[model samples]
Target: MADLYRRTVLVTRPEPGLSDTGFALERLGWEPCLAPMLRIYSVPMKQAGAVDRVIVTSGQSLEALRVALPPATPLTAVGARTAERARTLGFTAVDYAEGTANSLVGHLGRAGGRNSVLLATGRKLGVDLAAQLRMNGWRVTRRVVYRTEATESLAPAARSLLEQERVAAVLFYSAATARAFLDAFGEERGLLGSVRALALSPTIGRTLGAAPFREIAIAPRPEQQALLALLGPLPTSDTNTARREIAP
Candidate 1:
């Protein structure tokens, strides 16, 4: 008897980077495919200010701000990964909260004072951290660090894999990615039924709406590493392997 998930696995994260997940799936003996639903690009902030704190929600935002902001400025990150990215860029006085926009805002409200806070974010962001901070009376500025765009085309092979029952799971990192994926699949909801959707957070799951076929799985934390950990099992046998194709 073999494990059930050796079936094909699709990594449908919005970001173009799927090497990490690709390698992980290979290690588990499952075929992996890359079908990124969204692409991220950054636009730098034009002005400078001596602020109380800066909030970074995504790793890309942290990378963008590192090149523009002073190294010594106080910073708070939405998660350890973002904080780690900050540290790599020489931001020493950094604070990290649980990896959620709300959690990050709450921590900033308690820790950040009247100093003008800069929020580096996407062009179309969910859960406005800046708005939340302003409501709490902290001055906030936003730097559009990135843009997420849906891919115009999905790989034919990946599309075929998605249409068939080859995909064992679908991974979503953001709400935007979820919406774009659903759109890409069109009427192929039947394939989704056989797949388990692994969302990075509860918020991502909510954006997916009521799909008749797929069972949604959420990670304890909003991180890729956590998603893998929560799924358990190393996926050894053929039954455990999934035919996976990623669309970016």
Candidate 2:
């Protein structure tokens, strides 16, 4: 029999690339489904609190704030794309770092003394940012301005993709997204064992906790393209990567 997955993939991107990735996967002879496990919603201004600066680590989070906040508030973002989103959303003075929490914090250090900083993010927010900022003499606040809840039901097409065993690989961009994907399958989560797991960061891979899979590739960076590139046809030589033991 021929290889089951010559080319089909299921992508669990947060909320950014549904069309483009679908096109790419189509070109690769794979059926791509936009099983957006997490949904992004703007934090209503009525519920927002006072803050001097807003820190955005993801473009989606930045976009959510854009819809909720007015212009002129100083915005600090994680990457170029996030900065661009902020600018487009009416924040003229946008400061963005090299695209990670540590890098963004480092960039903030150079600017100095913002007094109060508010982090707008989803539910699963537990990074070492607030403590670091507090130690540095800045009052930091975490306001779950928005949330990305896992879809209760996968799209019919996505279910077919998973149930048919046509999925060759699954890409996880964030630890939260990975959890959402795992939850989407519920009790049948083991079905995912047949698909290779790809993660954008080691943080995401570690979240897998040894899920039954032969290969789990971690992208060096958080870029979508980089993550996808790592997923490109697994090498056809002596396999050096070890199998991940899925924890129950």
Candidate 3:
């Protein structure tokens, strides 16, 4: 049986997302240590030009470009969550794939419109999507709508829990976040040997780079629900009776 008392899972995504994930973890009876590995800063769009469609891979990109682009512009997102976010932001037409940039490329290819697409993404990111779209004969304009900078260290609470071997798992949402976490704490592989690394995707799991974790599990799908499912159900107990009622 898993350790019900030591259900601490380090959340390594950036904020806004960090809070949401933390809340979800708490509802599932896991104690979440909010440790952001990257900081996101919105970059103003200098020239978006007119485009028939917009592509957004992350909520951060959608937030950055929601006002810059027309709400009614046909928008394609990389996942359902991002697509829903686009809709909430007043986008009239939004489409999404099954939570991956590669899947998004396939979705666009099947849709078969070679129209110009404005891709709102973070700086130095989305190279593969842009290249793939161009190869498919679509006019692609890439715009850096956000910048993500790696943090120097993990949060004090997370570091303390890790040092004490109190953390049962670590949740990594992006390859960049995984890299940042490794860069900050790679020397402490011994400390992590008993900790599980739960990655949202295979790419992020690979970024963990042979870290001696108790286990490294990748989500069946590149989404939050699937990633959390890797943790399994919390042990049933009087302490978590309330949590169980609210858990999905």
Candidate 4:
């Protein structure tokens, strides 16, 4: 634990997304390096009337849905936080999916009533969930609620810390952000040798394939709490490396 306090972590998610992890890292005694890999912009979107259901794959999708989606419309959220946000925004019927696009697809498939619906997402998005829904016979409308752009480069502080090997861990929340982070540092793989890459899911860990990380740890579940829990153990501990806390 003392060794953890002496190192910093690179936070690569967008602004609000980075804040919660930042606070969590601070409480755990690790300095946070705020280097947002993605910048999210809520697009001006306004729709009227109600639909059969709504599918939100990310929290940022709510940027437009909060106004466009009626209070009574049923919603399928891809993550726990996204479900909670939907309910808070007045959606009464909310179905929660584990943090994966496939899981969300399964929920709609089982529901068997995923007919015509709005698929809220970012301008620059990952996982062609909308296309998948269409293939599954659901009439999906692509709604670009927000825009996510990659940061041109890492912040000076973040770059300095990374180059100095001062950061102990780098938390990755999504493959898109991971790709953006990788792009920012393009080919400077050795600089990351001292850092552990903590990924929120196996898909994310796979997205970082062959990166020059000292080690990679995938969380038991694709949730924020699960991701943070992986950091609770000592950095040198390998018993839990590459293993999900739950049986796969």
Candidate with top TM-score is 3
Best candidate (score: lDDT): 3
Where is model 4 more than 4 Å wrong at Cα? Answer: 1-6, 46-50, 110-114, 124-127, 234-248
Which ten-residue region of model 3 has the weakest summed lDDT? 239-248
Task: Assess every candidate by TM-score.
Answer: 0.84, 0.78, 0.91, 0.83
At residue 115, candidate 3 shows an lDDT of: 81
- The all-Cα superposition gives candidate 3 an RMSD in Å to the true structure of 3.9
Better of 1 and 2 by TM-score: 1
Model 2 residue 44 distance off true place after TM-score fit, in angstroms: 1.1
RMSD for each of the candidates = 3.1, 6.6, 3.9, 6.7
Alpha-carbon deviation at 190 in model 3, angstroms: 1.4
The CA lDDT at 198 in model 3 is: 95
Between candidates 2 and 3, the one scoring higher on lDDT is 3
lDDT per residue as tens, model 1, 1-248: 22343366677764423666777776767677878777877777667567777888887686678788889988988888778778988998998989898887777664344658888788867346777877888777777877778876667877786666656677777787788878776776555666778889988888765575457888987776888665565455434444444435
For residues 125-164, could you state the per-residue lDDT of candidate 3 as single tens digits?
9998899988987888999999999997776767777787
lDDT (C-alpha) at residue 207 in model 2 = 80
Residue range 1-248, candidate 4, lDDT tens digits: 53443267778888556777777776666667777788888886656345678788888887677776567788889988889877887889998889889988887783356477777877756348877887788877677789887787778877787776667789999888899888877878778877789999888899887688888999998898888887765454322112111100
Lowest-sum lDDT 10-residue window in model 4: 239-248
For model 3, the superposed segments whose C-alpha errors exceed 4 Å read 110-114, 240-248
Off by over 4 Å in 1: 1-6, 14-17, 27-29, 111-114, 234-247
